[model samples]
Target: MITKEDRERVAGWFAGRLPKQWQSAPAEITIDREEITVRLTIPDVDLPKDASDAARAEARVGRAKAFREETRKQRMEIAREAEHRYDAKVSWGLALGDHTELWTHIAAPVMTRLRQPQRMVLDTLVDAGVARSRADALAWCVRLVGQHEDDWLVELREAMASVADVRAKGPATR
Candidate 1:
């Protein structure tokens, strides 16, 4: 359970540690239990005002790829330092114009025991070809719920944080 202060501190650390020229804007840092993802927005490619949409799109992708390759060594060094300090794996991404790409992120497996009704839901997704297997179906379902209920989930997380704060303030059990 990461506190709000912990999140802010991590963000601040990245803001100061990252090279100024690397990001056109502040880095977007997302932290979970096992990973910390840092997404930086690179400056848009300078193209002619009358450039075609396809050309612009291609340039954006090229720019992001170049950035990734050029900074791979330096990024690895930074990620190693961050991972050591934070005790979590570090993932990197880039956002160029309207394009975003995440590379070298983890796909951690989760285990669960589902009841018959829950199993049926996943089976339905697999049977309908929405996913390749029950595991994929469960992931798909979670993603779908997240997309639709993001606001509610955020509120719930905030409430949980408040509960953690209250618990911390109470008398020590130990």
Candidate 2:
């Protein structure tokens, strides 16, 4: 928002820059400081579209531009920072130990698919504190291997082992 002083300064400055032809033109200008509104209207349009009219228009635009420089720069910088933060691979998965949230999310559905035997195994581990936190719970449930036996856990371990073995023998011959 511009102050009344700024408004008068700009209006007077603009009026002074107009050509002589608009000297007698009745101009209505209102500057709403809070809204940063600058309204300029020539209540008397009887004057010719000579140098004064063009000059006055130019001056009004110039004043507005000058006053808006800081705002424009701030807006552009904010937009640039937002773009910098967005990436396709935004480290969405666990890094050091952010797996806690992911576990809770997966658990809601996995509990329904478990067989009775698997459920008991999971319950025992969960009770024995094998799953220290959500992350640990998810690790025990999905990735624990040898010595982590309990049919379901064993199957998961074997599945992961198979994947590792496959990866080890890269580009296998047909």
Candidate 3:
């Protein structure tokens, strides 16, 4: 686990070279598998209070592009140093534009085939206002079960591994 000191060190190194707008933005760092991913939230542009929506949108895109181009080298250097120090691949992302669009979690769309009963259950959830859509209702249901059955899930995984091991062994000799 990377310590707070390591996080601070990396953040400090970038604060100087990053665009002024990003200097005060929060830096979020996480490690997955063999990679250390760093994301720096971009601050909102300092636009006039009377600025039009179109102007605000344009400013955001322009700022994000400029900031990315300006800091590309610095970001690479930071990633290199972080990879060396942590002995893991390092990646970086800029939290640009609108907050929701910028920080959305990256997930691949999944295609699933459900039985009639399962489909009806999800539909029922939506109709009852349990969730906004079938996808959301399914996600909520997953979260509910995951929260309640964490221990059961863990034990099930362990048992499956044990079974796999037992099956790998050839029939025992008497």
Specify the highest-lDDT model's number.
1
How well does candidate 1 match the true structure, expressed as C-alpha RMSD?
Answer: 1.4
Instruction: Tell me the deviation in Å of residue 87 in model 2.
Output: 9.8
lDDT of 2 by residue, 98-133 (tens): 111111012222324657786677677778888754
lDDT string for model 1 (56-125, tens) is 9999999999999999999999999999999999999999889999989998889899999999999999
Tens-place lDDT digits, model 3, residues 38-111:
67777778989999989998887787777778877867786677667667676666665563223223433557
Superposition error at 82 for model 1 (Å):
1.0
True-vs-predicted CA distance for residue 65, candidate 1, Å: 0.6
Candidate 1 ranges beyond 4 A from true positions: none
Choose 1 or 2, whichever is better by lDDT: 1
TM-score for all models, in order of appearance:
0.93, 0.22, 0.46
Alpha-carbon RMSD, each predicted model: 1.4, 29.0, 10.8
- By lDDT, highest first, what's the ranking? 1, 3, 2
lDDT of 2: 0.41
The best candidate by TM-score is: 1
State the weakest 10-residue window (summed lDDT) of model 2.
Answer: 88-97
